[model samples]
Target chain A: MIRVRDLTIRVGSFALEGVSFTVAAGRYAVLMGKTGSGKSTLLEAITGLRPIEAGSVELLGRDVTRLKPADRGVGYVPQDLALFPTMTVREHLAFAQAIRGWDRTPTEQRVAELADLLGIDHLLDRQPQGLSGGEAQRTALGRALSFRPRVLLLDEPLSALDEETREGMYDLLRTVHRETGVTVLHVTHSLTEAKKLGDCIFRLADGKIGEMA
Target chain B: MSSRRRGTTPSTGRSDVPFLVALGVMGGFYVLLIVGMLVADVLSTTPGHLWALLKNRDIRYSIKLSLISCTITAILSVWVAVPLGYLLSRYQFRGKALLDVLLDIPIVLPPLVIGLCLLILFSTPPGRGVQQFVQVTYAIPSVIIAQFAVAAAFAVRTMRVAFDQISPRQEQVALTLGCSRSQAFWRVVLPQARQGVLTAGTVAWARAMGEFGPVLVFSGTTRGYTEVLPTTVFLELSTYSLEGAVAVSVLMVIVALVVLLIVRVYGMGSAPVGGR
Candidate 1:
C-alpha cells in the first residue's frame, strides 16, 4: 500500500497543494486529471525525482518522505518511457539487478521471467531505437519489474499506443498486477482507461486530490 | 534562342554573382596562400636539408619535449573538463553565469596576454609562495602549465556542449532503477559522454601542440630545454632558417591533420545523444 498525506509540490508557476491519497495493497489505482493538473509532478515527487514542498509520503507502512528513489523500492515508467537509448533491452533489464547487487543466477532467472512475461524475449538484443512502440513499452515495463519493485508508477504509458494495442496493454497490466500482487499508481487523462484499469480511482483537480466513489 | 536569352534562362538558378565571386576569391586566396608557402618550401628545400633538420639534436629534443608536454596538457585538460562540465550542466548556483564567463577568459584573451598574466601571477605573493616549493615560470613545467590553461578552456567548452545534449531524465531513470548518484554518473552518464570526451581530448591536444605565444613568453623557449614545436619554429625563424622552420611547420600540419581526422570520425560515428 502507498499513502500520500497532504503532499504539496511546487514546480515553477504550477503547484500541487495539500494533496492526499491512498491505495490499498495489490490494487490498481488510476489517478485521473486534466491537462497541466500537476499529475506528473505528483508522481515525480513520490519517486523522489521532484522535491516535495510540504507533507509526507509513506510506502508499505514505512515513512519514505526522506528516502531516495532507489531506496523507496518503486518502479517508475515516465510518459516518454525514458529508456536508456544506448543500452540494449537485455542490458536495461540487467541494470537494476546489477545496481542492487542481486545474485547472478536469481537475477538472470528474474530477467528471463520478466522478458517472457512481458513478451519482450525476442527483442532483448535490440536497442530502443529499433523497437516498435508496443515493444518499447513492454521493454520499459519489463525493466521496471526486473528488480521486483513493491510499487509500480506509470505515467500515460499507453497514450502513444493505438486503440487495439492499448487494449492489449490493459490486459497485460491486469495480468501483471494479479500475478505479482504489486501495487500500481497509474496516471492518465482518459476516462475509459481509468474505468478499465482502476480498482480504486482518484481524481486530481485544481491541485487537490479527491477519491471517487 | 539568342545568347542573351540563354544567359537569362534561370537554368543557372538565381545565383548571387558578386557574393559567389567574393566568397570564392576570399576563400581561394587564403587556401592558396597556405598551399603556396608549403609548395615553395618544398621546391626550395632539398631532401638533405629536411633530413638534416630532423636529425639535429636540438630539433629532436624540441620534438620530444613538445610531444610529452602536449600529452600531459591534454590529459590534465580532460581530467578537469569532465567534472567541471558535469557541474555546469547539472547545477544552478550563485555566480554560475559569472563562472561560465570566466571559463572563456583564456579563449578570448590573446595568447601572449595569457602568458603575461601567468608570469605576473607567479611573481605575486600567493603564486610566489607556491613557486618556492615548485619551480614553474621560465621552466619546463611552465610549458605544460601554459598549454593546459588555454587547451583546458577549449576542452571545457567542448565537454559542456556534450553534457548539455544529454537529458537528465536518463540519469534519473538510472537512479530510480537502484543506482546511487555516483553509480548513475559512472555507468550511465559517462558512457554517453565518451565521444564528447574523445573529441575534447583530441582538440586540446591539437591546440596544445601548436601553442606558441604563451610558451614563448612564460616558458622562455630555452634551446633544448623548454623549446616545443611552436617555439622551435620561432627559434628557426629567429635564426633565418626558413628550411628548418618550414620542416617543423610541415610536421605540425601533419599532426594537426591526424588529430582532426580522429575527431571527425569519432564525432560522426557517435553523434551526441540529442543531436541530429
Candidate 2:
C-alpha cells in the first residue's frame, strides 16, 4: 500500500501544495494530469529523488519520507524508461537482485523466470536499443518487478508508444497487476488509459490532487 | 500558372556556392598553415638524414624519454581527471564554480608562468620538505610533473564533457533498483564512460608530447634526462639543426596521428552508450 498525506513540494516558481493520495494494497491506481502540471515532481518526491517541503510518505505501512531511495524498496519506471543501454535484457532483470547480493545461480533463475513471465525470454540477450516499444516496455516493467517491491510507481509509462503498442501494453499491465498483486500508482495524462486500467483515478490540477467524479 | 514538379531530395533549389566558398576560404587558411608547415619540414631534409639523427644516443634517449614521460603523464592525468571530472559534472557545491575556474588555470595560464610558479613553489618550505625525500626540481620527475601540470587539464575537460553527456537519470534509476550511489556510478556510469576515457588518454598523451615551455624552464633541457620531443625541437633550432627540428616535429605529428586514429576507431565501437 502507498499513502502520501499533505505532501508539498516546490521547484523554482512551480509549487504543489497539500497534495494527498493513497493506493490500497493490490489495487491499480492511476494519477492523471496534463503536461507541465507537476506530476513528475510529485512522483519524484515520493521516490526520494526530490526533497519534499511538507509531507509524509508511507510505503507498505512504514514511513519512508526520511529513508534513502534504495532503502524504500519501491520500483520506479520513469517516463523515458531509463534502461541502461549497455546492459542486456537479462542483466536488467538481474540488476536489483544482484545489488542485494543474490548469487549467480538464483539470480539467473529469477531472471529467466521474469523474462518468461514478461514474454521477453527470446530477447534476453538483446540490449534495449534493439527492443521495440512494447518489448522495451515489458523489459522495463520486468526490471521494475524483478525485486518484487510492494509498491510499483510508473511515471507516464506509455506516453511514448504508438496506439497498437499501447493497446498491447494495457493488457500486459493488467496481467502484471493481477499476477503480482503489487500496489501500482501509474501516472499519465490519458483518461482512456486511466479508465482502461485504474481501479481508482486521482487528478492533479492547480497543484492539488483530486478524485474525478 | 506554371506547375513544377517537387524534387524528391531534400535540397535547396540553388547551390549555396558563395556561402560555401566563404566558409571554405576561412577554414582553408588554418588547413593551409598546417599542411604548408608539414610540406616545408619534409622538404628541408631527406628520410635518410632524419633516420640518421635517430641513430644519435642523445636523440634516441630524447625519443624514449618523450614516449615514457608522455605515457606516464597521461595515466596520471586520467587518474586525477576521472574523479575530479565526475565530481564537477554531478554535483553542485558552494565553491564549485570557483573550483572549476581553478582547474582551468593550467589550461589558460602561460606555460612560462606556470613553470616559474612551480619554481617558486618548490623554493617554499613544504616543497623543500618534499624534496628532502626526493628532488623534484631539474630532474626526470620534474619533466613528467611539468607535462602533467598542463595535460591533466585537457583530460579533465574531456572527462567533464563525457560525464555531462550522460543522463543522471541512469544512476537515479540504478538507485531505485537497489544500488547505492557509489554502486550505481561504478556499475552503470563508469563502464559507459570507456570511450571518454580513451579519448581523454589520447588528448593527454598528445598534449604531453607537445609540452615544451614548462619543461624547458623548469627541467632545463638537460639532454638524455629531461629533454622530451618538444624541448628537443627547441634544442635543434637553437643549434641551427633544422633537419633535426623538422624530423622530431614530424615524428611527434606521426605519433599523435596514430593515437588519435586508435581512439576514433575504438570510440566508434562503443558509440551506443554515448546517449541516455
Candidate 3:
C-alpha cells in the first residue's frame, strides 16, 4: 500500500502543492501527465529520493516521510532504466538481496526465479549493453521485482519502446502484477498506456492529481 | 562523369589542394621541430655524461626525492579531487560557481607566481603558525606542496569530467535499492569510476614529475635534499654544464614518455551509462 496525503514538493521553479493520492494494496496504478508535469518528481518523492515539504508518505502502514531512501523499501525503475554497466543481469537481480544481506543460496534462487518469470533466463549472464530494448526493460523489471518489495515505482518504463515491444511489455507487466501482487505506481504521458495497464488511472496536471474514468 | 560532377568536387578539390598542403606543412613543421630538438639533444650529449650524472650521489638523491615527492603528491591530489569533482558534477549549491573559479585558480596561475604566492603566504601569521610546528619554507615538504598546488588542479578537472560522464541516475537507483549514500558511492559509483581514478592519478603523477618553477622558488634546488628532476636540469644548466643538463632533460623526457604511454594504454574508459 502506498498513500501520499497533501504532499508538497518544490523542484526548481516548479512546485506541487497539496497533492494527495492512494494506490490500494495490489493495485496497478498509472499516473498520466504532460512532459513537464511533476509526475516523475512525485514518484521520486514517494520513493524518498526527493524531499517533501509537507504532508506524509505512508507505505505498508508505516510513515516513511523522513526516512532515507534506503529504508523506504520501494523498488524504483527510473526512465533511463539505470542499469549498472559493470554488472550482468544476474548480478543486477541479485543486488538488492545482496545489499540487504540475504543468504547466498536464496539470492541465487530468487535470481533464477525472476529470470524465468521475466523471460530473461537466457540473458542472465549477459551485460545490459547486449540486451535489446524490450530485453533491457525485462531485465530492469526483474531487478525491481527480485527483492519482493511492497511497493514498485516506474517512471516512463515503456516510453522508449516500439509499438510491438510496448504491447508485449503491457502483457508482461500485467503478468508481473499478477505474480507478485506488489502495489505499483507507474508514471507516463501516454493515455493508452494508462488505460491498458492501470487498475486505477490518475491524471496529473498543473501540480495536482485527479482521478480519471 | 558529367561536367557538373567533375566541376563540383575534383576541380574544386584541386583548387584547394594548396590550402590542404598549407595545413599539412604547418603541422609537419611543428612535428619536425620536436623531432629535431630530440635529435639535437641526443647528438649534443654523450652516453658518458648521462652515466656520470647517474653515478653522482646528489643527483641520485634528487632522483629518489623526485620519485617520493611525486608519488606523495599524486596520492594526495587524487584524495582531494574525487569528492570535489563529484560535488561539482552532481549538485548545485550556493557559491558553486565561486568554488569552481577558485579550483581553477591554481591551474591558470603562472607557475612562478604560485611559488611566489606560497612564499608570501608562508610569511603570514596563519602560515607561520603552522610553520612553527613543522617548517615548510625551503623544506622537502615544500616540494610536495608546490607540486600539489598545480597537480591537484589538473586532477580535479579530470575527475570532474569523469564524474560528469557518469550519470547520477545510477546512484539514485542504488539508494532506492536499499543502499545508503556512501554505499551507493562505494559500490555503484566508484566501481564505474575505477579507470577514471587511475587516469587522474596518472595525470597528477606526470604533472608533479615535471613541476619546476614552483619547486624552485618554494623548495629551492638544494643538492642533497629538495631537488627534483626538472630542477636538476636547471641546476646543471645554471652551472654552465649544458651537456649534463641535456642529458638530465633527456631522462625527464623518457620518464614523461613512459607515463604518457601508460596513460594511453589504460586511462579514460568511457562510462557505459549515464550523462545528458
Highest lDDT scorer: 3
lDDT for A49 in candidate 1 is: 91
Q: Going through the candidates in order, state the TM-score of chain A alone for each one.
A: 0.98, 0.98, 0.98
| Candidate that would win on DockQ | 2
Q: Give fnat for candidate 1.
A: 0.62
The segments of candidate 1 whose C-alpha lies over 4 angstroms from its true place after superposition are B1-49, B263-276
**Clash totals for all models, in order?**
0, 0, 0
Q: What share of the true interface contacts does each candidate keep?
A: 0.62, 0.73, 0.75
Name every residue pair that clashes in candidate 1. Answer: none
Across residues B38-125, which tens digit of lDDT does each residue of candidate 1 receive? 7876676666876787789998888889889988999999999999899999999999999999999999999999999999999999
Question: Which of candidates 1 and 2 reaches a greater TM-score?
Answer: 2
Enumerate residue pairs that collide in model 3.
none
Rank list by lDDT = 3, 2, 1
Report lDDT (CA) for all predictions.
0.89, 0.89, 0.90
Give lDDT tens digits, candidate 2, residues B75-175.
99999999999999999889999999999999999998888888888889999998999899999988998999999999999999999988899899898
What value of lDDT does candidate 1 attain over all alpha carbons?
0.89
What is the lDDT for A75 in model 1?
91
Model 2, runs deviating above 4 Å: B1-12, B16-22, B270-276
Candidate 3 TM-score restricted to chain A = 0.98
